[model samples]
Target chain A: MKIAETDPFSFKEMRKALFFLTFALMVLGTWMTFFYAPTEVVMGHVQRIFYFHMGTVWAATVAFTVVFVASIYYLVKETAKWDTLAYCSAEIGMLLLTLTIITGSIWAKPVWGTWWTWDPQLTTTFILWVLYAVYLLLRSGAGGRGKKARYSAIFAIVAFVDLPVVYISARIKRGISPVVFGPGGGGIDPAMMQTLLVVLLGFTLLFILLLRERIRIMNMETALYTRGR
Target chain B: MKAKLKFIVPLVIIAFLISWLVFAGVRDSMVYYITVEELLEDVPDVYGQKVRVSGTVVHGSIKNELDESLQFTMADGKEKIDVEYDGVIPDIFTDGVEAVVEGSISTDNIFVADLLLAKCPTKYESDEARYQRKKG
Candidate 1:
């Protein structure tokens, strides 16, 4: 549970700095999206939704990739820190995944002319959301820490397996979902791509900040529980 | 260490097998998009292949063949393909609307689509622009 040799004030200052940076970067990303990024010839201003939509998915991918690796390490090493890291990442990944689905759906209404479809990409993403949500529920709505951690670690691995499938679902078989990368590459403009990369970097910072804060809280709670026991 | 090794070996093998099966299954079922040009280049070659062809609906080429069946010409500037569909046409389906039809070309060179999807016009104009257009 010992996070640093530095004093409590230093930790507080670091958190404040991260919070300010994350907020400032997010605002800057938004400004660039609306003004700097040219309106897409095909989708127009509505295409602006693409920045946040893809950004959240990129960040969620980072978080879940960590969950997959950490869960395996936890199983082998039986370390509490690995399990905590997996759980924290899964929580943040799930929140961002929800945002991805919601924003994608909003953009879909004007672009695809439908609010939702059972397209492979959409379906696989939904399944992932359910899987991670169950991971969280199993952790809290069940037995002791040992049992819950073991169960959730296995669940995290199973859930991570779906990530690749969700990514390639649009390319697989006859589906209406657009492909951002592949043979055709969807013909994205260079300016739009630049904005997307900027937003993605901003969201990545936000993800790291959120994961650190969540893990600190979890470690404190674990410390309290062990002391009480 | 011996017991841990025993547990680890089977887990790795099982994971490998499962991933292989998933990748193979997904590859077999993968449906990809193609342009009108691509579809025409190999009508016989692509015939019966489960495929999606996207293009703009040719202006005035739409003909309501019956209660459910409709015929239209889909063009992507370079080429055009005849598409026949018997499904609930999307509200956005109209002349010049961008569309992607999911099905395959028949031996007769008609794109028999089971699902017809009309891409909506990108909503980008500001309120002022829209109002000026409307007023004009």
Candidate 2:
């Protein structure tokens, strides 16, 4: 299967489609964040950051998942294309997740008294951030493809272990366990749940388009480099 | 797939368990922001509870009492908030810079601050003063 589009007809169409999806989701997410959700009966307008925070986080999670799956595929298939996808997604995921964490910190400053908490999700993500950063650093400095892919794959396998922990903690806290800091603790209000679902779906669609574009650009660069050689 | 799952499944399960608690902590007792009027309306119901209050520092309201506790009133719109902070205040803590106080209200109508943060003045204030001069 083609890793990226080459057809003239599909190229323009896909670009247009991706662009529209990204902007539409951004606009809808912005609007709902500003006007739809109640102004947090206490925090006033600043609370709107929650929607943006969640949207970016939703996109980052999906991108990281792609990175994980692509790492596995590249290892098994020995295809550079899979490697390229993993690299691109990892980079973009880094950018988006970094933005998400920063914005979340800013939002927390106004409400949570401090810029950060050693809460599980935040702590786990910080660990994941450092782990992936080292993975990329190794990829750039590593000597050979065989070793590079192997080490990165092993790192990916270990790094992503945090994902399940994050997911399970959120779920267990809300559903069965009466824990203090659980996800959707006691579940979300109906309106918040609906709004969040819309935002999550929209962000996921936008992320897919972004991943496609990144992969396309990455493939083009690879082709150009090979031709030059 | 099987080999991969062997490592992934157990790790995922443990993370899932911890994450549930994380979600609860973040979602359950999220701190709230309010003005003085709102906090008073709720009284001792909010005593010893966590909250954030935003308002202006009343020019003459500050009193650094004998016990080294600082007390001041903050106003937002039609409401004025009174706060007692024992800790050292932020550097910018002065008259009329919009500030946010964190912590809880005491039963005695004093907003006991655990932390205090003041907003930096926007550069546009000089521009507004210039415009007023041109008009007046």
Candidate 3:
């Protein structure tokens, strides 16, 4: 209460604005993905799923990056706030990456003639997912707060190595996954690019909204625990 | 610091072990598909061994047999191989599209593929461009 009074930029007001903005962008992004973006020539309608696929993966990437950074900060500062941020972000990242895998498999079933294949990119992504899931499990199973946070922080940082590999594997190695935007990438049309950007922005905003809510709950829990102690 | 070392040591060892396993596994199977040229060159070695090969579907070479089996010539540059597949074909399996077939080569040099996978075009073009290209 005192903190809210002292802070000029009200957290409650900012969260309300973020909620509305994220909702609006998601609606607009869906409309553009379905109606505005032109159908791909070869893949046709199934290619439409690419928008959501990219969006989820993009947000997941941001989430994992936050986990990495926050984990490092937690190690350096030994603060519970950074540890909470890391844990919450990892949870959200796992959710988003799960969506990414499901969307990708759905698209692959139609386009690639198989539900799944262990191509380098897919393999690396699967590894990344399992690594983070293990990090979450380790954090939860570890008993004490200080030791648990410290160990998981180190694990999270080491796990971040796979994130970049998931990205570059398709490019550097031979894989069924396409490199859409980068060196050696086959670029998309301008309209398709616009749609992808919109969806990606929407997903990013959604991620921020979810992270903010999760962090608030986590902080409250920590507060209650300390008060009881 | 000493307490931290207790945790860090095991973490480092575990990380090393995992990375080593991943590296070894990837190196053993890194090439997702053998190119037509490689497959052809290694015909003697790969004969009757289950392998995945990738090549572009040769234009005007796909034929659907009466039994629902499909046959096509897959090409990589000048190197080409005949592929026969009976499984469900991908929606995008067409002339000039890259396809990966998983099967073994018969004694007669034909690839009998049990699974067929087509690569979607990496360069995504709009319907307008497709129509324009069709017209011109």
Candidate 4:
């Protein structure tokens, strides 16, 4: 394969394509997450958040996984690109995670008697939010690239591994998680299941697009750093 | 390179389009609500699936395992159903109050509620939020 040149300001046709596709995906995802799924007769309309919940959580899972790996890779390789990728992934993931919390809270308020709960998963997600907040803080502080990558990577790896377990136990472990496995008998109806699938797919596609754009940006930034030196 | 979204963008779009297709296949599995009488009429269809059952709390049927859990039987004049819950019973859940349970029924005929909701009569307001207006 041909080596990529070091260029700070770069654009790619393929990347642009991906962005457009992602735009389409966002449209499709919103439609499916909102419209395709059937409303709960009991919960009324607010249950729509579950579809968004699934989508954002799925994106969060991928982002967390990337954070874990990139952290390790950055530590070992001490490469700028890996750290950059980790930063981008975490930033975007946290944004989606924030959406998850917001939508989840609104969904819960009317149904769960409050907007927040004391469940392990709910608490963990809150903690993850804090950790990422720390990550952002550390990134901006006056440290060389080496120390920044070393510490943040360690935190990222630890946090990523714990996210899923928290999700499962919280989702399935009744009396333990806020809503239990199936609050509202918490499982999906056939119509709902159908809508949820579409939303999930649309979001998946959107993720692919976003991920590509982020990676490209990382690559371009890496090129500039090498060129400067 | 011509700044164009060529093969790269199309592949991504196609992937998302495919996900939407998969969702379409499973959408029919979604279900809806039916009355207790309707549920009784078609127990086989609703056996162990989620649903919303509405009725009055059978006046004397209230049982508080409220120490550990709470159980009660609800009826819509003609049909009676049992409900058990293990969370803080909403303050509004009491005798003669109207309630709606969101959950499924078991083979033995108890409603395994995941959510319990109740509405109080006369909309009590000894002390109320800014949103309430007191009666003269």
Q: What would you estimate as the lDDT of candidate 3? A: 0.91
lDDT of 4 by residue, A35-88 (tens): 765555445566667778878877877887788788767766677778988888
How do all models score by TM-score?
0.75, 0.60, 0.91, 0.57
lDDT of 4 by residue, B49-132 (tens): 877766778888888763777799888788888888766555446777666677888898888888776532322111222124
True-vs-predicted CA distance for residue B77, candidate 4, Å: 23
Residue pairs in candidate 3 whose N, alpha carbon or C atoms collide under 3 angstroms: none
Between candidates 2 and 3, name the one with more favorable TM-score.
3
For residues A80-131, write the lDDT of model 3, one tens digit per residue.
Answer: 8999999999999999999999999999998999999989999999999999
Docking class of 3: medium
Candidate 2: fraction of native contacts reproduced: 0.01
For DockQ, the strongest prediction is 3
DockQ scores of the candidates: 0.19, 0.04, 0.61, 0.03
Instruction: Write candidate 2's Cα lDDT for A1-229 as tens digits.
Output: 3644555457777779778877887788667766665544334466567667777877888888988888778766767887878878888778778878898788666544457654455665786688778877877884766778766765765576666555554343211111222443333334555567778878888777878888888789768978999
Report the poorest 10 consecutive residues by lDDT, candidate 1 chain B: B120-129
Tens-place lDDT per residue, model 3, B1-136, is: 7775675577668767776666666767578898999998987888899999999999999999999999999999979999999989999999999999999998899999999999988889998987886899
Best-fitting candidate, measured by lDDT? 3
Best by TM-score: 3
The order by descending TM-score is 3, 1, 2, 4
Which is superior by DockQ, 1 or 3?
3
Candidate 3: where is the Cα deviation over 4 Å?
Answer: A1-8, B1-29, B133-136
lDDT of 2 at B85: 85
